[model samples]
Target: MPLHPFHGRALARAIACAIASASLGAHAEDDPQRATTLREVRVSAASHDTSVDPDLPSVVETVSAARLDRLNVVNVEDALKYLPSFGIRKRFIGDENATFSVRGTSNQQSARGLVYLDGLLLSNLLGNNWANPPRWSMAFPENLARVDVIYGAYSALYPGNAIGATVLMTTRMPDRLEVTGEVQAFTQHVHDYGVDRDYGGSRQSATIGDRSGRFAFLIGVSHLRSNGQPLVYATQALSSATGGPRPVTGAIADTGANGLPRQVVGINAEGQEATDQDEAHARLTYDITPDVTAGLTVGYWSQDMSHRTETFLRDANGQPVYAGPVTIDGRRYTLPANYFAPSTRQSRNYLYGASLGTHRDTGWNVEGNVSYFDMDRNRDRVASSVSYNGAGLLTAGDGSRWRTLDLRASHTPDSIAPDTHTVSFGYHYDGYRLANASYNLDAWRRGGAGMLTAANGGSTQTQALYLQDAWQLVDGWRLTVGARYEQWRAFDGSRATATAGVRYAERKETHTSPKASLAWTVSDTVLLRLSAARAYRFPTVNELFQGSFNGIALVNNDPRLKPENDLSRELSAEWYRPNGVARFTVYRSDTRDTLFSQTDTTVFPNVTNVQNVGLVRTRGAEASYDARDVIWPGFDLTANAAYTQATTVRNRRNPASEGKQFYRIPRWRANLVATWRATGRMALTLAGRYSGRQYNTLDHSDIHPDTFGGASDFLTFDARVTWKASDHVDLGAGVDNLTDRRYYVYYPYPSRTYLVEAKFHL
Candidate 1:
């Protein structure tokens, strides 16, 4: 199927319409309090320390704690929901598997980005897909001071994962005694696929902090409880079965994403889940000197989850049908017995971290950090039969853990001269061990480990050394150059079943990456920058050694797989004015040996798993406008539009993917947010998000998206209102997905949702 012509240029049309409105709606000269810094950013809105100017030539986005309070702050990820060209897989309030996506990447690619909290790595590098998302529940929204995002892999200080993006979250240290508390509640009504109901949740958080002389301590806790909407529906392709069918009603005749006929019977698999999550964290910091500080942080998170399934099909006598043959449109169909079975999971995670760093304007400075993350206890109970308390399986990950270490030093000259420069050097080490084992159980909910059923486990390690230098070439020109050398190894790869177990030999590889950035200040109000880099991303543990099995026979395991090589480049032009700033950017990326999961349609029976593709090319452009007091004294606006096109150039094993659009990446994305302050303490906001055409299959076979199992265009609007009751209290209300548009991204997204919140401070 061919794309609709007008929809292909969605970014262009959206930008044009927005510009037309802004020209007539804004008065740039109205605001007197808005500040702008062009050549050098010496003044900021926040009081936090963020002098990491290493990502000079790339586009960076920053938001302060004050700005976050105006939006719905139920979850920390909500702070980034309005950013441009960003995709987050936060299905519900307490979803534990939320992943991050940016630019040309998909939300399922969890290992292609970096997330840090107070210099501690939060990204789980054990795997490369949905199962390996960042550990974000440990950071409560009320405890953050600021958040910064750096685009592209243009800095030598970070690993190859920086090619997607780098996020830095800074926690606050109080100057005096402070206590804060917040409570929030939300609800959403979903009506889709013969299922209609209301799902809702609630959250509560509190933080206490104080500073006494050279010592400071902070403690925070938060909890969430939610009932999510149905995420899966049972369906079977229209087939010719040679058997008499039982008459059943409520079976929906539908077409699949690929235009194949199917019957939608009921919700199955990961149906509706009731989630309860709790997290606690504490931080202690001491100032050895006025410019030197040491800190220790401990965080713990836990989740107890269970599920409930519902059926729509019924027999002739009005009895609900759980399984067996049924007739839909005179065609015989059989619903699997285990289709509506539910599973339960319990998870306990802990993170301990320490950091020692110096804060100085010039001369030598040193910093050291180390963190350890462990899955203290984990169990996933899966049922094989729908019968009550029947036999099942238990998967345990009790010994899975990861460790990280970083040591860095930097020197800055006192003055800007021909020989003056800022030099930074660092050494980094990271290790991850995955230990997962499954055993047969006598009962689903109340059962112990019985016989060995299946197992998959592996270990990965990376060590790197890097150096970078930034210097002023002339009056208005600055240049930066750097390189990183890394050695990656994978070992202790093993898989097992009831029969036997097997281990893979150790594998090791070394690679060097180069990076550069150049910036030229054309004038006080304009600047131009160019950045280029080459990154090598090593395969993760699951991608290297993990495989599926069919009755003890090995399948889908690849021992010989190469790393991914990516060459990325970007150029940007920035304009500054009294009210705000505007920027235009273009970027391109060429990659080889790309690690991804795709189904080979050329084969007789489709096989879906992780594989390496030969070549992929992606290019895009973005335009952004951010200004405060655009029309009135307290009016602020921020908007951005982007266009991206990613295509597969070559693939030897999966030829059907060549010359087709890459999976899950939309061709266009746009966002808009505006705020109006009615009084000194009252504010109202309106926000919009858009995503254009996307495909679920690499061959572009999933046409007519908007059905289940397809990646479709997404567009939604959000609004929020906040009022300061007093100097120590605040209240807020908001709505998301105002139109309740029906859409899909392989799963039905949230429908019309309502929110209410209250906060107190002393």
Candidate 2:
């Protein structure tokens, strides 16, 4: 295949950056010229990238505890900030609405990925957008032992949500005794059109764990207080506004994402957030004999958040204008009542999990775990308008929860033929329910629920069974095959308005998917692998039942939606030495009945709803290189680049998007990190991240992505230094967005930020 000129240029730039990164090192290690075996590769790989499961066919990218401590990790999600071919949509330090992006998956598609913390499911799969981000707050950075990311749905042990990837987070339990404490502070300067100031935050955490005889216990807690930059802008299409004599100043003239005349009036209340969040976690583990163990984990998280807005427009008297019609350069623009309305929110959540497992080196191994997430108290209060802080609306989510259960068994028998085989099977179950309602409030700050205004809620459940076998066919040859059968059902769905409500009929579906992979060792330093899999992602509850009633008729949703069927393929080649490992991979995904919220243009009325598209296609290539002592001893480098071309293939309902790029998926991305160990106790590091321009719409009409509401291209640099003052204390400092370049991913990305931290260990 030949690359187009546009993509060719990007590839060239990536190669140039790679060269620049390699040139930073001065001394290269001379590895011994010896024949290596598969055992050597497995050991070396596991030492660096600890594996959650060694039998997984796909390459697992991981960040170990040692690596995590060396980096400037503000939150648990930061540990995955620089992984190969990965993107995280964490808008700020205390952002709860954060999601992950991988090959062929957009950042907003949360259902395409799955996250697990110590065998507990953290992904809120009720929806696939901002509100459904994984519950990273449940586990703090101080307690994370390791995090592993597996790309593509090539394993039978996981469900269809693993199509994009699967994240497995393991928190450590002390064997003897351990104590750790950390404090972090960061500040970032912002200079957007109307907002210009410095925002900062601070965090503190502590963890203590110890083991006595056959029992071990660990406990950790963290608290964060942060203020973030404005996320939503109050803008008007000047071309459509009327001219008036009442004049106003301070509005900035600009072009909208659609390349149209626009005027920025002020900021919205969505992202100008000041947040205080707290999390506490505890775990207990007991050994029942030598090969059997039981464990329990409990977690709690609380959040107090407030949103504030500011206006740029001012009248002749120099008084601020937050709402109503305002004239800017003789063009009159009307700001809606909610344009600058302030709001506040509070939430308390709990998680409980338990597990029992038996481990033996030669016979059958069994493992079972169960987890539940409870939304104890969740409420949000919003002012009615800019002038009215006394009365508004209150949205409460009281009975929302999710639970998961898994049971698995594996057998490793003696080799009976020319090849040896290891077989494993598992059963999985998950269910989710949400109950959200909005009511009128007499007082926005403190008031009782007056009257119910609207409600939308639903429930979804899934059960699955899978079996997989890993076989050593011959010398340097291996093959793995797996299959999964899943049954999904959506029930107890209801959507209501002020005057009417509707209950949807139950829906059920069953699907069986097949997975296979083949690996061959070409030489001592090289290995090649091919993988293919068919997976299905069922419709989420919110996608099927969350909608409004227009004159007693349902709108904006479709309960008759179908599941997405996906077929993915990948080819990977890896080369490893004692000092480093490198890989180059190409992958493709062809999905049928892809889900998207669009209008059905084939009909005369052009009804718009959450519907299924005919097909979508994506193809990409990725190259990752990690080396120590690249060109010089004591120097290390990690770099990766990816090119993805994702587009809508068949969408008769919305023909304009049939051949356009997928929303929110960038075309090119790259990351590079270089570290220099100045001494035995000090280290200095530099990192850079780049993401190509992307559109926020399906029709590719938003060519101007640099605006306030656009997904734009950005390249950022970061630096960090670490010094071990003693055997039990570590100090670190870092700065992100070193140049303070302004960019937007719908919400402005972080500007130049300074971070400092101190860690005490015992």
lDDT of 2 by residue, 1-762 (tens): 111123434653765567556645424654442222342123223221222556677867767686776777888889888887788898888998889888778887899999998789999898877788888899878787778888988999999999899988887778779999999999998887867799989999999999999899999999999998888887888755568756889988889888897888788769498899999999998889888888899999999999888888888999988777777886667778778889999999999999988766546888899999999888999999874458899999887999999999888665423388878899999999989899998888888998999998999999999999988888778888999999999999998878999898999999999999998888887888889999999999888988777788777898899998999999988886666667888999998888777778778777877788888899998888777777777777888888889889998888899888788888888888888888999999999877777888888888787778788777777899999999999999999888777778888877888999999989
| Backbone collisions counted per model | 0, 4
User: Candidate 1: deviation at residue 372, Å?
Assistant: 0.8
Best by lDDT: 2
Give model 1 RMSD, 1 decimal.
Answer: 2.7
Tens-place lDDT per residue, model 1, 1-762, is 212223536645776577546645566573444455543331343422533453344788777687798777677877777676788888777778888878877787788888888888889888888888899897888888877788878889899988788888888889899999989999998888987779999999899999999999899998899998888888889877644678778978788999898888888788887999999999999999988989999999999998777788888899988877777667777777777877899999999999998877678889999999998988988787676678888999888989999999988787656646788999999999988889988998888899988889999899999998887788778788899999999999999888878899999999999998887889987888888999988888888777878876777777677888999999988877677777888999998998987665567676766788899898998888777777666888888888888889998778988988787888888888888988999999998788888888888889868788877787788899999999999999999887776778888888888999999999
